[model samples]
Target: MTGAAIGGGLVVAWWFLPREYPNPLTPARGEHVLGAWLKIAEDGVVSVAVPQLEMGQGITTLIPQIVAEELGADWRQIAVEPAAAAPAYPNTPLAKRWISLWDPATAGLSGGVDDMLAERFATSNAFTATADGTSLAAYEQPAREAAAAARAMLAMEAADRWNASWEECEVYAGLVRLGDRRASFGELAAGAAGQSPPDPPPLRPELADETPQAGSSEADAGPAASFPRIDLPSKVDGSYRFAGDVRLPGMVFAAIRHGPNNGSELTGFNVERAQGIGGIVGAVKTKRWLAVAATTWWSAERALRAMEPQFKTQYPVSSEDIGARLDTLLTAGDSFKTHETGFGEEAMARVDMARRYEVDPFHAAPVETASAAARLSDGRLELWIATQAPEQTRAAAAKAVGLGIEDVALYPMAAGGSFDARLENDHAIEVAHIAKELGRPVHLTWSRREEMIRSRPYAPVYTLVGAQLAGEGEAEGGGAIDALKIRAATPPSTHEFGRRLFGNLTPWAAIRETTGMKDELAMEGMVPPYALPSVTVRHVPVETGYPSGRVRGNAYVAGTFAIESFVDEVAAQSGREPLSYRMSMLGSDVRLAACLQRAASLAEWDGGLDQSGQGLACLRIGDKETGGRIACVATARQGEGGLRVSRLTAAVDIGRIINLDIARQQIEGGLLFGLGIALGSPLAVRGGLPASFEYADLNLPKLGDCPEIVVDFLPRTDGTAAAGFDPGELGVGVVSPAIANALFSATGLRLRRLPLLSGGL
Candidate 1:
């Protein structure tokens, strides 16, 4: 049988099975349960359940806005509840997208968004991971459906009391009214709970959207955000609670130190020295790590420093060794084809132009380090932490303490910032072991140095791009491409990450499992968006001793840096304007072309003339019809201090806008993040650890260093009900190339590597 047929059979069998799931959101005494997603309070407050983490992404408000917009509730009365992990809230879209990671054997069986197999697997496992910008895609419809159902029920109750037909009643602004008679949702909350909703709930005709008025000033833009962020007040007043804020009656602080490299064994530590420290509780030693617990975190950290733990590794990872491996692989190693179109390799027999680009590994460097609080009592473990994959964290904690999965209670907490760093559960496992050993509550936190040593960085990549001209006798300056080929030498980072995340294997074990596997995700965004006759993208997986995993922007950051930099070089060689050269190739990508045009206009295009100090780049995230598009223009100069970026102008088309304020915030933040990558240190590794641990050493752009950024969203002309794409990572991938191109214009020199000055000008 075909894979789809097997998936269909499983779906049929699953429907007949008894699947009873407890509601994660329990209503308070005065609140009535509307649906799994929300509850209506007697005081007219609507509490919406949000399954995704609020790591400064405004999801806490975004999800609630979707619910309130659909239910016609007042924005001021809407509240947010961090939902617990349950089968009721599964990120189906993410599950489908990551089918190959979780179940490699049956990955090909169901990878579609609507596949029942993906839904069943996600629901059964309660896989509510928050990554890849899939929150809006996965939870929007479910939230809307639940809100719609509650709206109908409320209207029915109010209609019965008024002796009018429920179909004739209108619900708006928290009120259910029939002509003049009306009742607040709060007043009908008890009766609505007993009322049966329509078989198919009455849904609003349009999705939530807003269009920014043309020529609007910064002051005018403030009013466009109809529903302000719910967490803003508490965040400003220092009342917002994160995982690190968790406290228990008998809780003690713990500090841990892990081996520098994976597979390293902890030799020993100065137990006598650690015990002599004041306020020291005790120390727990494991094969791979040592943890010191004390009355306060400072004492615990001090104890660890005094103990001086020693580790032994078979081979320590170093930047020299990694660079040597990439250099050798890029020239002669075997390659596996990951993506192809049209003629594939048949048309790439002869290359007209070729360029090589190298990108060093990048650290996520989230403000918050790994932290988790664990308490074990009577074979039950309660964990408080911010994790992208809550179920995985819970399972890891349970296994560490030798307890059943059900014997764990996980309290979801907001993260300070993850950037995919929180996906790893080592801290969760460590806290569980410490709590179990100590027989008391233990809050474990890794120091900055320890975080840099233990956390995985983005894989370094070496890429060689070749292009063929359109005609046989065409000059190099023709600026027309016939074929393109890309060969990237890097570890199978995503595949390795999948093994660690889904298979629950150690980093070294995961690397062993996916040694020579082909990873398309590692080569994502390699194919050019322009019209090309033939293209071939290849991945050469090279092991570098050290493990690398997911970071914000994933492979796109590296891919775009290579492709866009090469494109800009091509434009310079062809004696054509950068913007026009790109525009000519965009045959059917009208959205991206529009973005480029608008961005240029916004920045007052100067045609990228010599010493103009302006550069342009554009990118598309998904597909042509339903994807996020972005174009960025950067203004930079070679100042006395160094490369100084004065301004950045961006035009984005994420289909229909959901919340204009949040969208702009994401784009602006992503741009600055990309700027950091463009100019910050390469985070070179030495002796199996990062060379620098302090944030100050990274040379990141501070408030005074930040450039002026202007972001504008294209109004949706297709319709009002268009699907909105996630704008979180779009700006991140496009800014580096734009900045690179800008520097080239200013200096008349081409820097063909990430961190443009890594090798020195």
Candidate 2:
């Protein structure tokens, strides 16, 4: 396949197009392969290859829907396939996202720092097709270009046969038509083969330069306002295969017994009598590993439970230990200062109001347990696992078996759910190691308790806010925020993640020093959009033995919670209406102000706290990496159960909406997820291990706990200022603060910590 299509725009596998076919879906004679993303068969059926994982996010459906719309193909005839591992199919959205984290002016430098980071992220093969709300934005440009190229190729083929210029032919509904004479894509498939795909007639603008909401003007697939999803049919018909569905011949079920906490090693075990059970296969034991293989999973479970393996450490440190360390760190001085706008240390001397808030550690608890099935035979290793980072799994698995990545075929399956848990593929590597050592195919699934014990929870965060308000008649009326200083302390999650990304070769500290972003994990999404004369944000890095990783919104959620909550405290202390105080400070940030206004109008804010316990909060968040802007409002009340979110409304602007139905669904999902975290999901630690390992132990919100949520997309009909768009939802970052603000309005007490834990409301 050729690298460049017509007009010099990149098509499929544009970065590193392969000389030979690289995917599993091979085209037959008379069929054409459009680069690496699309293929048209002799029967007019179109296949779209997606590199992202299908974790119930509707990405697989949305991506192909985009292609079908641009290609003029019937949605019914389109099929989606998982793409193979290749350097060409990189996570472009993530690359852009990392670059977005940097603000040239805020970083105290200008030049090409953002460009250098973007280049570094794009070339580095660190991410896989996992669900991170990046799929829609990442694949939008590539999918549109590939489909447009395919359309052009079909038009050219029709023109050649009709003896007319390509301009005279129009492609519609998978048919090339000129006046009344028409040719089906299947009929012109043979002629289109070996010809370079041409770009669409209307040259598309570069994603970076395009105006925001440009997609609102573009036509989507189907005449009906709501587009149908592709996965529902297969899911309803029971044809969709998850990791549990794979039943290979001669495969033995294995159960693992590892340290309860992550990074713990196995010490000893006793399995003599347990292995004698019926349908028992052998046992695989290593210094740091312990597993029992049997004919059935039940048998393996019985053997494992009976064995009762021991680890080097059991509940090494308790919850009190982690809490003490965090409290000490929060009280300590700052180690790294991220951004300083005006007054710096001078603002602290004139502080009019100050508040301290904390977010306790919580879990990104997905329903699915970590699982992997591996077969080692003939010096080749094959793994079928529910992993978000399949490329990382392939590399880690190959290294475990002492084989090259080429020798390992990693098949990423339909995951039940994943926020960031699947990003850590230690289980897949463990399964491969066991399979290789036993010289047999093994299917290892961690029990529910094991998954919880090994879960990488979000680190606890503490923030201290000191602000000086403006006097009456000064700058946009009275009570305007003049200067703000925020100091946040949290265990560094990104540094550890960076270490995993670069391995032992390059230290994470080196990357942090070179980038000058010492603790992005603690400070992102903490910056307020209010027009303040002076703003200083200090990130105090803390060291902890507890395992922490990115979960959904990551630092953004924690940072927003602290920043917004502190703002509410300041407004209350200043005796100004909370909403009005925010609006007064939002000078010229129309998008954010508009969202707050819309939400307030929807909720009918009357400048008084709801006696029935109503709270209102407005937020404006923009992500440069995903190209998204979200303004959300949340209303809460103290119901019979206490702290019930009665309603939530959001005004979203994320470029163009690919599928309105899916977009709304994602927003709703994001709201529920944020609510769960805001309400509670504390993973108590004791003896250096998670004390709460069962689903019942986690105080996750139920359907009854969640109130009605209303979402409205901001109309982008003009398409003037094109900000990049990511299809992911935005409520996670703002929910906690919104809810906390609501609680304060309902009651006189202000909640400084998250999960509202118990009677705090």
Candidate 3:
């Protein structure tokens, strides 16, 4: 059958299959389920089922807060449970967004969250993969409706007892009241479960939101968070469990070593040396990796080191080779136009200014390395792991152990910090194999060296930007850019990642399948947020012989870095101030323009003249209507040790803020992450392996290295903006270019490459 026919057949089959899925959150005795998303207990405690993984993003709290606000439940009584992989909870938004990746041939069959094909596919496959900041967009409305229905049911139950109309009852703070009569949600739980809901759920008119006080001082130190994070208490008390904390009866620890890169195979290992190590249980060897199990992780790691496994690489990757490939592709390779606007490339025959920028592959470098625990018994496989794509992980593990998908059970756990790193499930698959080989429960953890060797980093990019400006005598400096063109040379990173993620192909096979394809997702954000009359973006695919996957900010990081740096250079070439030059082209995007103006005001605008050591940059994440906007001003100077950033001031507009505290925390964290990428996180490939495995060697910013950060959110008027746009990635993309521009302002030299000092003085 053709690809489209197969996809259509699968969707139809899924539709006909039974949709009933047992509730993952089973109610305790005396508790009642009013909706699929939540349950109410006799103690008046509300347990909300969160479908997304909690990777320190405060999602556990955000979702419950929405329920509490709509259901009129007390925040103090709220509890959270991780939802099991089931058909009832499908991330339709994410499914629709990634339709092109998962079902390219039938992509046209899916439109939005309401698309039947996307919904059926997501539901049947239990596709709850969490990436791309789609949690709120995917779950908010359904959660609200569920909560509203539950509230109505509770009121109906209480009203019947009081001989009053349900519509006349008041429900708030976990209580239903009718004049002199009052009853807690716990008192009506059993009765509420049997009560019929209103035909149309009575949703609240307003969404959960918080407003920051005006002025720099007030905004800087906003009111205390109304709803504190739910996970903080357990996390602080060391009671929360991560994948590394999973311990089972007779569970042996396993440490693994994988070949450096794709197209590599394990050749040999010294079994005698490994057996001599104390506490060593046994060793498992595969075609591409070797693992040693022991009583403890340290012992297992030590045994693996003693074994001294060897691997042979057909084509070893090196930084120099990757760079040469990018350079060559950028200069003479055939380019595919990913996006175009206005006159497109026709107006790029002559340009008033041009510049080139380069960015090397950067690792995600999450705090926690890949870890998983697996057990194989009675023709079944059980896995405990923190994965963004739980179903995919389970399927991969089942396939690895030569079992059907129905024979696998996956227990989800919280991740330390993924930044999209947990999307890869190689560790889960390896642990399954190790457990099957040993016939015992095995907890496998990839050593930092193995993670650095096996994990795919973000793609390397080489960009050439050209612009046409008005005549010099027209306005102050050379006036506004009349036309712009950008040509970026990079591997089809997103396509390759999708091949591995959706197709479950090996890294080498993925690369071969998508070597020359144009990846529009990889070229996302290349279209400048500014209002240029004519703009064209071209993607020049380069086969870098190294696998690349999604990092935190994805393409936005590289795109913003190149665009903002080039814009700063253009501002200097013209006599216009950097801030004003950007603001001039932002007439169509008032939200971003407002952010730029506010950020400048907060940072004490200085026009970026006379080596002032202040640089400015702004970006829009989604689009003009519903996207998030951010503007940053970075202050930096050359320090004795190296480059030092003293402070960063940013003004952001993420629409109606859900939790102010979490939003600010996300932006602040994203800024620091971007800073790490700007100054560290360079992957230097040598013989197909990362040159350094230690985190300390990456030169990531320490507590002392972190600059004084000031974040101010643009206050929204009633319904002026869309519901909360994700603030997680907005800060990441803008910080790099802001720091680069600041460095140029500090020194006379413009650094066109990431890791600012990489190009040397």
Candidate 4:
């Protein structure tokens, strides 16, 4: 419960004088947590403050979508606000201990990748670290600990008043009861008002630091009793007073021109010439850029454009050029600690067959996208932006403008879609610095050209697979191909997962590498989907030049493509259908078989998989309930020009479903994101920059692009299902490979490259 609290005080900017209204990304430190406030306002009009901002992923609708299911309030009345970042970090329970782990560096506060590590907090196992305090053991530690603590405090308070042993007390819902006495929490809320919440928190015997003692209270009571669910109506109706919808009296809109490109600094500029322009309030030059302040967005833009900029690009590396450079970085670098599984060297020596595959993912038209809107009130800079990491933006802006952290207010609005791009605060920080310097609210949206020039993209990974088949099989070209090995600059990642939860990467060995099952490098075709008793997989890590951030199922996509393709080959080798081959390795998970059966029925896989060439992919995100998580099957199809996803049929058995609908939406959304990367969104390099400009040119799946999806949830019939992926963790991140493999089955063409826009489908 103890961590470094962001100190000092909030600077209240009073001047509401006309200016561009702020976007929600500019975090406003709220008094209560978003979930807390949303739950408290749950009477009739539940106002849910979403912790995650909505740039376009529809978090505004998504969070409320989940909350409305629980709150049972009218969805029409729901209102949302971007939750403030004052709780130090967003209210993620990924690693409850992430905040409580007591780091000596920041004194129990979170570290740089708090957002990444936070994923683990949602688990349920205890004992904190692995038995030896190394890896995380379980999930929902924060929720679990908080719930247990609240229960303990309630029991203790009841025990003290009833003059009875705390051991005799049991807390249910929001009530404390003993033998013949029962009291609702509302009644005790008043009496317990002044009482201090327990230090180190309360606990239950199960989450206990020590064995339970007779007649005593444990420290980990369930906080589920204290923090209630949010009930805010979603902004589905579009009536919410969003920053874009906010208008104030005498407001003046403005726009600014920073040094060419982003991160370019101004040599210097004269504002006197700008003063001559009509309605020109002022021209401010900050450390890195220049901004034009005027009465209207047009006035500022016109004046700014007219005032020819005099700056030079010091490091003129455009986005397109950066992209090509990324390839050179790959396949040639000292492997930092990416991940390692079994004995890599031993596994490599066993390889007798090898083939190289190049994945030239052209992520076109890179753009430094930002969601920011703000105004200067009195003298303070108040802003809102659509950002993945709010803290990163504030720090950057504050540092740029030389303003005290208190002066820069940020509200993390709903982000559009995070491809690790939103996490870059440079765009927002530059805008804020410009606005503050001009003494005007500046709204800066990147030009299509600029957007493509400044970005980090997924790696253009090149992988080499070496296979050593037990028996000598004639190669398609008359060469013997077996004793396999996979060496690549980029290892297969399950959704660019690098966090402690199911996202992080670990090395895999020959026994673990069934490279063909999903991605030759990632699963090393060693996925349990096959019945291979003896196999080996190895890795050779390389780096990429373009800034690579978390892309949806980053590793899963490439890895699965290689793995499942290999699986198809194995099936072809055995003269068995791919589905039959997959059915063989599924003894470990009969539920997986059930899901496969259902998906097969839905997609009619049993009828004619070979003829129709439908392929499936399933990955396991190991956990406590199901022992291991298996992304049952990501189903896909092939069409004339492009791969038409018939449906990403999924069969998952994650235990709890907080919001049945959102879970489906999240999995579906993630699935589409990965597909978008495959179909038409690979960022490319043209003359040292990304070629695709805006989404218009990028060609992501539109409303029409979405497939006919069938989500299958395996019943915990034996009370043996997982509690994570609530709604369900289908892990559709790597499902594209299955789709690709299926398409290859249908078309007989191997497109290792992404976006079949070249008319190659």
Q: Write the per-residue lDDT of candidate 2 for residues 609-725, one digit (tens) a residue.
A: 645355555544553322455555666766687566788777665555667677677777877888888887566777666776688677777777777887766555444533335
lDDT for 215 in candidate 2 is: 34
How much does each candidate deviate from the true structure in C-alpha RMSD?
2.8, 5.8, 2.9, 11.7
User: What does the lDDT come to for candidate 3?
Assistant: 0.87
Task: Report model 4's TM-score to 2 decimal places.
Answer: 0.67
Residues 1-761, model 4: lDDT tens digits: 11332333221121212223222233233212222324212122335555554544344554554343333234454556556554422334334333323221332344544543343232211112111111113223433343344445456667779999765777653456898898654345334423444666554433211111222222121222122223223345555433344343444554555443323456655555566678877666665555665676677777767776566544444544543443454445433332334443344446444444455553323233443666667656677776655554665676666767667787655543454456455566667766665555666655454455444354455655555544433233222222334445553332222221221111112112212122222333232333333334444443232333334444445555566556555555545555655666555667566656766665666422544656666665433234323343444555555457766666555444333444455566656666676676455544334555566767877889887766655444453222334321235345656666666666666555544333455
Off by over 4 Å in 3: 1-22, 108-116, 213-217, 220-225, 474-477, 718-721
Worst 10 residues of 2 by lDDT: 206-215
Count backbone overlaps in model 3: 0
TM-score for each candidate, following the candidate numbering: 0.96, 0.88, 0.96, 0.67
TM-score of 2: 0.88
- After the best TM-score superposition of candidate 1, give how far the Cα of residue 151 lies from its true spot, in angstroms: 0.7
